[model samples]
Target chain A: MKPQGIKVLQLMSSRINKYLIISLQIGFLFGFYLVGGYLQKTLALPVPGSVVGMLILLIGLYLKWIPIQWISQGASALLNHLPLLFVPVTVGIMQHLDFFSGKSLWLVPIVLVSTWIVMGATGLLGQFLANRKEWDR
Target chain B: MMLLQMFFWLFITLLLYVVFRRLYQLLPYPFMIPVLTCTVVLVVVLTSFDVSYDTYFSGGQWIDALLGPAIVALAFPLYKQRKLLNKFKVEIFATVVTASLLGILSGYWLAVVSGYNEMIVSTIISKNVTTPVAMEVASMTGGQPAFAVIFVMIAGIGGAVTGPWLFQLLGISNFLGIGMAFGGASHAIGTAKALEYGEREAAISSIGLSLCALCVSLLGPLLLKWIS
Candidate 1:
């Protein structure tokens, strides 16, 4: 066989393997999500199952039970594209337009003011304490 | 026909999301944020076409379902931060906890002032957290998930835009302060903005974002109950 043909075959095989690994890791994420849902139903927890799933994964990873490689690709893939997932949910706002009408639109300025106030407060406190800690050290 | 319609909305959403995401990358403008832009464009298109949201969501729901696993995927980042978590846990915790509680207070106060109902108040309460988590927190607390997202966007973008200048204005130059303040207040977008400061700052920003998210998720319900 030509060397070029062999190289092309190897490349194609690696690509297939990469995809298989990605899909398998994604399957793991879904499995954790399901377990989270199950725990939520049985425990009647107020916390959302997905959030629970995340905590479980965090504990699992931290304790070295779940290797990072297990979900690195899948997790990064999902997180990177996470913003895209919200497009539909955000679009869902169209149904609730009446809620945004009337004086309720005051939300715009209210958000601007609150964000400024809260952000400013947090920054000042964080800066002060962190600098103090540096001085202590 | 039902199946075709369902596929159509789903396809259109994916198409718009991908194309706009590319454009956002090329443009990198604040208004070009793919999610906001896509939402605006899709909403306008659907509204002009006289299609009800329910009908559009018949297909869009497929996309929405991905949010569940995506939330679970959130753990990956927190896990990656194990080292930073311990090293700066004190500062991150001290500031983010206060920030989280204070953030909730601020939102609740404003909602009351604005005469918002319990539903809107609860929705507003989670505004400072990341989008997916905020949605979950809002839903768990009996707020509208969709409505919660709007506030998250406003807070995230608003923080990203104003935070750097705010920091420079106040002469707060420590990486810890820059990160914690931005992350606790702004979430993902703020963390992205922190990338300009440096990688360490971005790392701190991410941890701050997650810790604030965790605080808001766990303590948010009880805080709302106590404050309300």
Candidate 2:
């Protein structure tokens, strides 16, 4: 076949696979929804469907049924946009700014400091665990 | 006015996405800066325009609704790290329990010193979890879920921006340390950032973060009630 013919074939194949990628992502989302619903109903849990679906998908991946790279692309893309997902939430926080007036200023520093300390300590602890012979090997 | 707010959100969203894509190319981890900065800018701009959060929030809730799904997807990374997790289960278990306990105590202690009332203090305990969990904990404990969500958001944005700097200042360089710091401080969003840097780090961070939140949700109220 001519180079153009080969080029066309490549384009066609890529296009077909692109849809595959999107379908898989949607499938993962749906799986999350279904499982989330079941967990919510059966367990009387607050667990959402999407979360359960994600766990299911992760299990599938860990078992080697699903490739890490396959979902990683889509997952990373969605994860990258995490802030956008919370835009409304933060704006809502701004809405409640009045609640944090002079009286609440102290809370910010306290939360900030404690958050830093706890996080810092946890981080160091993780490192310590990782370095331990029992964990490192 | 609602339409205008939606347009504003859309505009900011597009601009931020484009800017973050560029920054990600240059920096090892640039997502937090854009995310935190965008939040600050968006809130400032919206408030300046005199748009009520109700109007802005309703417009933005479309994204907020997806927050739960986004977080649940983190199990993928958690799942991916099973080997490492298995290797460190004992340590991970120990660390998680301790981390969660410490996280709750420190958070509450700080809230108390910060002069927050009982209701606010209850909300602080759940601030480490994802919105849905935090909201549930808040309602059950008699604190405002709305307030908890905001405090959580502030913690997330604050942690995402400051996490890296704090690590460097503390001379922490291991990926595990970095990931835990991000997860512990910022929860899911921070874990997402950790994943970009390294898989092991991301997994540890993700587990550490969620575990801490769950522990806090259970213990925060108990401690608060006892103290009061």
Candidate 3:
């Protein structure tokens, strides 16, 4: 076979395998999500099912019930493309234009100030704690 | 033609996001974050073209469905950071709890002071937590999920943009401090930005957000009821 033919074959085969692995990883993550949703329904937990699923996954990985390699690829693919998923929801802001106007004009400044306040206050406190001589690791 | 048009919006979203993402990578500008840019452009295009939100979402919902699984995937990074988490457990845990409480209380106070209605107050109250948890918080606290999302976005984006600068101004140089700050205040979106800073920061951020979500969910309703 020609060198070009061999190169093409290798590319296709590798790409195909990568896709398969990624799909499997996504399946594993979906399983966790299902369990989480089930638990949420039964327990009436305040936290969302997806979050609960995440905690379960963390514990699974920690206790070695789940192998990191099984989910790593899928997890990263989802995480890296995470922002893309939120695009639709973020665009939902169009429906609520009324919130930015009339009596709600204050929403802008309030959001801005409170945002700064949270980050600034936590940031300052985090620094103070990090610098403490006692907790030094 | 109808089928093509149905898929057209989805195609446009993917194309725009890829283009903007590539551009952000090359330039690395903070405000030009792909999510922000893509949403802004999509909204402008949809509004100017007189296309309704429902039409765009006909295709957009496919992407939206993935948000749940992505939430589960958050465990990956948190697991990776198990060592550091174990070491500084006290500090990280304390800071995020404080962040959740402060963020809710401050936002609540501002809305009350502004004389906004009960709905607005509820929506803004859970703005600190990630979207999933924030939505639940919004509903429980008598806010609209839609409005709560906007506040969450604002908080996340604001924290990502100002976080580093604020840390610098406040003299917090450690990655742990910075990551905690981002995750504590902004949750998922902030953690996403922290990824650009460093791996350690992103890892810490991942856990920071998860814990923050839990804290806000458990405490948001109780706190809101007490205050109001």
Best by DockQ: 3
Rate residue B58 of model 2 by lDDT. 59
lDDT of 2 by residue, B153-174 (tens): 7677767767777777777777
lDDT of 1 by residue, B1-228 (tens): 989989999999999989998998898765676777888899899999999988899999988887778778867766776676677778877888888988888888988987889998898888888876788889888898877877887787778777767887888888778888878888866765665566566667766776788789888888888877
Which residue pairs in candidate 3 have backbone atoms (N, alpha carbon, C) closer than 3 angstroms, thus clashing? none
The lDDT per prediction is 0.80, 0.70, 0.83
Better of 1 and 3 by lDDT: 3
Taking the tens digit of each residue's C-alpha lDDT, what string does model 2 give over A48-95?
A: 355455666777776888777666655655666665676666666676
lDDT of 2 at A30: 48
Off by over 4 Å in 1: A127-137, B114-123, B130-153, B156-175, B186-214, B217-228
Among residues 3 or more apart in sequence or in different chains, the pairs in candidate 1 whose N, CA or C atoms overlap within 3 Å are: none
Fraction of true contacts retained by every candidate, in order, equals: 0.67, 0.58, 0.77
Local error of candidate 1 at A133, Å? 4.2
Which of the two, 1 or 2, has more DockQ? 1
Better of 2 and 3 by DockQ: 3
Which scores greater on TM-score, model 1 or model 2? 2
Which tens-of-lDDT digit does each residue in B1-228 have in candidate 3? 656766998899999989998998898767878888898999999989988999999889878877778889978877887787787778888888888888888998999988888998888878888887889888888899887887888888777767767777777777777788888888877887877787778877878787888888888889888978
CAPRI-style quality class for the chain A–B interface of candidate 3: medium
